[model samples]
Target: MEQILETLLFASDEPLTLARLREILTPGTSEPRDDGQDSVAVEIKQALAAIRARYSREDSPVVILEVAEGYQFATNPRYAAWIKKLFKDRTSFRLSQAALETLAIISYRQPITRAEIEEIRGVEVIAALETLLEKNLVRVSGRKETVGRPILYATTPEFLRQFGLRSLQDLPVVDENASQGEEAAPFIPDQGAQNPMAPPATDHQNN
Candidate 1:
């Protein structure tokens, strides 16, 4: 069963959750087992641990990782430099500057509609939005309650992990503080400007 799980994970393009594994394994009643345990949870946990230990070996080619609450196998991080160098000239996976700006706006003003983003940037951003979606950095959270019911966008868990933020509120903000309570950048938008999607003011600065 563990070997089956490993093979399925290796063949899968996306991370597989425990529930998904259960669905696949349940139908294979004749599968062999090591611990003779009937509790699926215990067996799964044990299997995961064993897999972790096995990959801890220095010679392993792939490593299993738990990301976004699912398990997947990826080439070991130690080999990442070589993998990156192999694809250094590829442009498909890289983002353009405009796309990055659009993504920043979406990240900060998530659950926002396309119209709102356009309003803030003073430009259409369809391509940027599509690129971000393709990269799995953003997703459709829901539709706006407005007349057209435009789709709302929000960052994914992958975004948080990539940025090393524990939560959304941990995102940095430009300070407006001064000694003795004097205002700095008083004319600049406050918390609202903190939105990732907001266009940068002429004097705006990152924290």
Candidate 2:
């Protein structure tokens, strides 16, 4: 089971959740035992724990991480500088300061409108919204149920993946004492790491 889990984790390009791993491990049957405990789930967790332990050595170059509500292997951030050299020539998606600010607002107060973002930033956000949309980081979730029914924007799963977050709940706590004019700090992805949580190289032009 450990070997199978290791191979699956190594081969997968995205984080694998427990349910996903179970589905792969036991394709056609229910996992609940007569004792009412989920045997497969218990075994999977034990295997994952063992796998994590096996790779927890000080000299290990990689480690298992739980991101986007699943598990995957990523190179240790301590070695990020050396790993970045491998992808130095590849095209990477870069967000402008304006776009990042806009994204931060949307992430914290999502299902928000462009006008709301503008009001907070004290500036128009059309271009920033466009950049976020192009990157698939944010999306038009729906329209606000108000007079004009302005389009509402929300962060996408890609945003969670790119930012290495398990969920919006994983976002850093906001500083309540922060000035009203101050924007939330954007969650930046670790670049050039061979981790599913890291943003992948793209063909799009930098924003």
Candidate 3:
């Protein structure tokens, strides 16, 4: 079960939630019995533990992490500097701090108006919003039912794919301070490190 779970999580681009894991582990059940489901949950928990322990070994290049309420493997952060060197000159565009902050705001507060986003972020967000749209992370979902009928923005599937999220429900609970005054986000290859989808970055910033 540990090997199976490890393979599934490692192969998935998005996070796999507990329910989703259960579905994949046990297919075609109209209503799983409570006792059976409980046992299955325990098995998955144990497997996850073993998998985490195995990847924590010193020789491993990646480690599994719970992000967006699901598990995905990430390169160990301690090796980021060295890893950056390998793709430093490639065609990649790292989202700027402002872009990240705007993205975080939009991620948590989806179907939000640009006005509301600016209010929360306390700055003009046109450029950041444009950058996010260009990256295919944010999209105009609909028009708000307000005086101006402002265009609303929500995260796209690409956002989930890039961030390893199963769904909006999987977003990490945000404290007020963290939401408003968040700092620069560390770079994670929006696309795989080996294949950058954007043009080459001269200043290592996407925005």
- Misplaced by over 4 Å in model 2 are 28-37, 91-93, 175-207
TM-score for candidate 2? 0.74
User: By summed lDDT, which 10 consecutive residues of candidate 3 come out lowest?
Assistant: 191-200
What TM-score, to 2 decimals, does candidate 1 have? 0.57
Selected candidate, larger lDDT, 2 vs 3: 2
lDDT of 2 by residue, 42-149 (tens): 898888877766555333566777777788888766565666777898767799999999999999899999999999999999999999999999999999999999
- Number of the predicted model whose lDDT against the real structure is largest: 2
Off by over 4 Å in 1: 28-38, 85-89, 96-109, 118-127, 134-136, 139-142, 155-207
lDDT for residue 197 in candidate 3, whole number 0-100: 31
lDDT of 3 by residue, 31-144 (tens): 433464577766787788766565554335566666555667787554666667888887665899999999999998888999999999889999999999999999999999
lDDT of each: 0.68, 0.80, 0.73
Error of 3 at 169 (Å): 7.9
